[model samples]
Target chain A: MDKVENVRLVEMGQSNFIKPYRILFKQNKKDRIWDGIKVHDSVSVLIYNVTRKKIIVVKQFRPVVYVCNTTNNVQEGISIDTNKNPGTKGITYELCAGIIDKDKSDAEIVKDEILEECGYDVPIENIEKITKFKSSVGIAGCTQTLFYAEVTDDMKKTEGGGREEEGELIDVYEIPADECLKFAMDESYDKPVGMIFGLHWFHMYKLK
Target chain B: MDKVENVRLVEMGQSNFIKPYRILFKQNKKDRIWDGIKVHDSVSVLIYNVTRKKIIVVKQFRPVVYVCNTTNNVQEGISIDTNKNPGTKGITYELCAGIIDKDKSDAEIVKDEILEECGYDVPIENIEKITKFKSSVGIAGCTQTLFYAEVTDDMKKTEGGGREEEGELIDVYEIPADECLKFAMDESYDKPVGMIFGLHWFHMYKLK
Candidate 1:
């Protein structure tokens, strides 16, 4: 689903996600400033299909990845052409996740995300909390709570892709549990830290 | 060492870290845009002291964390008082990490960081490579290459507390291997995802 074209990047004018700030603090009488952005805290899930013994994952195009890979130092006055920098660089294998913008509990949000993104109806009681950690503390120190759940083949109901109305085009895929660590380490596939950590956690605690 | 004072947060001005941008693209002939920031790619080390059978970590005061914990919504023209919002929320136990600004190999840079931030002298050969991952994909997607190294008490050449010239004040400590997962899971200790993943990796592959 990465049929991306007509890519253009520019200096940010209006942003829906970034709220940049500078914190000035004095430690041991020395003044220091740290620059960061305020972002939404989110939740992610690592889903395992028990009948097939596979890790269900979602693949989609990420704009930040595309922009960073295509731009060199983000030099001003220079425009990027998609031909020179292919859009394939932006595609990544990610865990089913959603930003915490709803009033529902974190578990409910993730359960709903699983159904919307991967076409699975996971029971709310079956969802297990793994842990939550501060993500990317250097720039944006936001929290991301991770969860785990086991699903069977019967649980699948629809042809899994992200919500089309939201302009999302996600592809559903799976990886064998035994090969997850290897896949996580592979440089060919771009991935996030949460996915890698979840894969390792699964091999350590699950798939016995 | 979270003795912070005179904490004030304001709208970002000439940030040395954040460079915000907006990207516009067409996927399947549908127009879309994404907001993100360009930040420094970094390096982190998960150091395990073979002689002590413990994981070496660094605790420091993060300005971003402190400001986020204190400020409500980053409202403009409003000043923050540190007394009302304690600075302790800014303190975190993290892996020995440094921004990849220096013109050296990632391994050499991480080795130097171990000495400056954690007071250890790990050789280049002992520094093993872990998988690199994209961090905080939604906002500032930057590459963070992780490494692992084992050291002995002899490597403790100095009292590790970061470089004073750079205005860094870090405390060095260790955690027992058997209890590391529990410590990483503890909500009382503010930490980064890289540190948690590193701890899990150490238990899965490093510890005998």
Candidate 2:
């Protein structure tokens, strides 16, 4: 599913997603102006298909990760050649996640994300909260509430590939529990904290 | 140590930390441009004092977290009043961490952060590397390598309160292992995924 090409940086005005803000804080010794971005808090879920005995994961291309890997100079941008920085490098393994930009509750958004990204229609009653934490403490400081749930094959309604309209080319994967842990430990794979925490949580609480 | 006052947002031209960029990518179906930022990757360490039987945690004020709590508007910023949002609200419990800006190995940087932020003089041989993962996948996608180290009271080299010249007033706290887990679950405390993952890792591997 890696058909991405001609990745070039474009100078833009105020971003719809990341808004830079500098806040002045008077410290005890010296006054400091801290630079941070205002970003949306989000919800993520770690899913286990009980019938298949596999964990559900969504894989997608993250432009930010790609840019970070290819771009050496931060002040100025670079033209990312497909030969050098392939779309495969930008691909990241993540728990089914959605940013909190909608007006619905966090759990509702999680449900919507699962159905849209992974083709699973998980019942809201089956989801369990696994605690809330900020993934990026220094930059965004956005609270991401993590959840866990178990599903069956019957929960699958369609062949999900995320929302094509929003440029999401997600690939849904059903990996066995052990394989999932191995994948997380594999340094070759690009993964996020939610996935790491989810695997550890499942290992500690779910695995017998 | 919560004497922060007159927290107001200032409009700046370009950010020294976060530089926003829009990348145009040639997709399979429709051409889409993704917006992301160029940010710095960092290192964090979870420390356990073997002699004291306590887990060392650094607590400090995070401007981003504080601003997120105080501001309601995203486009136009709001003034953060101490009456409405206390400096304690901005405080986050983090592993001894530092952004990757110095010209050194990540492990060496971790050692410096431990000594500077938590005042622990850990032997380089004693420090062990945990798995690496991106905490903020959508936004920064910065890879943070987690490390684990065991120290003792005798290793306390100085009263670590972070770098005061940089306006960092960090407080180091050593909580019992069980209490650390309890604090992680407590919803009132602001924390990050590194702390959560580290706690679970300790609970699974270190705790007897």
Candidate 3:
């Protein structure tokens, strides 16, 4: 089997929150038909509060899931809501996550996010890695790092203050462990990595 | 506490697989201002092979993860590659996955993908869900459904014909079970959901 090679980035450009990069490639097999391809790397996180018997989840807006859900509804014989306008379905729920900033350790960025997004101060020792995974492939390129920590109920209430940026209204919730698992299984939870790690932990530690 | 009002999708549109949807808002105490928001939703899958002790994974040209990795290298004093161009990174490994086609159960869609992408005919009963989680928020609106299945080693030989329309080039491999967890943990693995499920199953059934 031929080994898959990694192409290096040659050019890059970024705006406020969006960044684009170029990659170098070479043809491998005689199939020269498959010469080279470019790809993207992304960062994501998962936070679990074991002591509180809950997980820190955020409810916000999501545009893609909304479209898929709407399209599914239309195909399933469910009536579409005609009064609503475009981009309204972007709200979403997910674990505290952000792209990995350049030059920052995964732990450092995740630690900061815990405070900014969930208002909790998580010690590095307590932030155990659940796993690293990919988020999507169609267009956006991101890989997520899922982590867990045991936050007490007291911590949930005292450090519950969250970030409020322009057009970003985040609501932090201390979801019950069982309910969190149910939500993860049902795909009702907002983010994909959150549900993956939540259910993973449940399967590993909770489910007998 | 005021009840969290149910959000409704108002309008939606899709262009070249990049979809953006609009949502309607029911006002509550949380906010007295905005009447609606825009959102997006997407789907992903985690394909596992229990019989072969390997899991299906994909390595693609990810413009995002690649860029992020390059940025990290620049910060670390590593020289950037100057020979590459900007394009989608196409890597190979994994079972079958795609954005949910409108109007189908995620499971049903994934089951079909297993046949289309992996060339396996496993019963749906074997398709165990690991979790549903989100990928990113600051940029894209999407969620993923991670899943696992037990497949025979011979199943690995099955050809996963690529989806040309979608530009998906798929290949099937039956990696060793013990190495799967380690492979999944590597930075290159990127997608952790399938690994998470693979590791969870390993700990529960194999390693335990």
Candidate 4:
């Protein structure tokens, strides 16, 4: 029960566009107890530009909000009235991020994500591993690798618009450092990680 | 398109612990769009016991490491692993949060979460909405509600434990404000949001 033991995958499935695998392991903790657990892995990125003093972000429709609002009978979740379907498309504002593809370095994956999501080519100066976090535990064992990047104002403009994907139609926007924090703290923004971390780094390096 | 509209949930189901639903909505943006999204309408509590100058955090296991770890052969968009069983049991660190039940108010939910997750009691002051964030976009549209709680040192004890429903194995740990940031940034801590915002708010309020 003292040495490293072997691990095995138990149940594996992909549903709702998420690939999740459960594992069973014999842990040599104290007396070689049999244990099993599930985990989900994903990736995220934070794009920062030094020149324009702005960060790249995107807005998209999120179906979950629509569901939450409707099921809870909450009038404020997301406006998804059948009569107003087109306009009330799920709106989610987020940072430039994507699942890590095989054969690509974290930098490469994030770089590609920057282009696909925000159309930016940022030199991955430093891959500051922010935190590997779990988005939800009750259902999916999904965890994400969060990283930060450095860019400039010219880089922001040159990157241009995002490449529209099959089911995704996104709009790229840039907000100043101060405003980024303001937006992140604002409830209307919906998603806040990218802006939260971007503003933190800005204050840590620039303001300080 | 300029006015707000209502939506209805046609069906709801649970997929691997996450609740998914189909919705029918009407809007003026384009046309009718049937959306299916995963809804995990949960609450995250950032507990700060001002009297103790400490915060509560929990650590558990995560399984997504295999996929996230590039060294593993989970590339080419291969969602399943047949060679090795990647088990999902690792010590993860995170904040005290629980899914919001249908009948509880936000304040009531947080109060209940505090006791169930960490075995503490505090008078509900006010629930400050941090932001509703989409943990991942590539998958279902699941969003999380983040909140903060102010408590006193008298509210906690040395051996705080989780509920029987939580498998009765969670070990609640109190972290001082100064060191919470470092722990939150560490990869070993399974959950990062509670620590992240906990430290952020501590520094922001302390400086003021």
C-alpha displacement of A133 in model 4, angstroms? 3.1
| TM of chain B vs. native, candidate 2 | 0.93
In the range B12-58, model 4's lDDT, one tens digit per residue, is: 12234333333333232323333333445667777777776777776
Q: Which ten residues in a row have the lowest lDDT in candidate 4 chain A?
A: A1-10
lDDT of 2 at A146: 93
Model 3 ranges off by over 4 Å: A1-51, A63-68, A71-91, A102-105, A153-161, A178-180, A202-208, B1-64, B71-93, B100-112, B121-158, B161-166, B177-182, B186-188, B192-195, B198-208
lDDT of 1: 0.84
TM-score for all predictions? 0.94, 0.95, 0.63, 0.72
Standalone chain B TM-score for every prediction: 0.92, 0.93, 0.62, 0.66
Per residue, candidate 3 scores C-alpha lDDT tens digits across A1-208 of: 0111111111112223332222322322111111111223434445666665666776655433443444533121233352453334444666776656557778777777777778777777867776665544434435566666655545543444355444445667666666754565555445555455556565556544
Q: Per DockQ, what order, best first? A: 1, 2, 3, 4
Candidate that would win on lDDT = 1
lDDT of each: 0.84, 0.81, 0.48, 0.53
Would you give the TM-score of chain B in model 3?
A: 0.62
User: lDDT tens digits, residues B48-72, model 1?
Assistant: 9989899999988777666556655
lDDT of 2 by residue, B125-184 (tens): 878998888757777777888989898899999999998877778999876886766877
Query: Could you give candidate 2's fraction of true interface contacts?
Result: 0.78
Candidate 1, CAPRI quality class derived from DockQ: medium
- Order candidates by TM-score, high to low: 2, 1, 4, 3
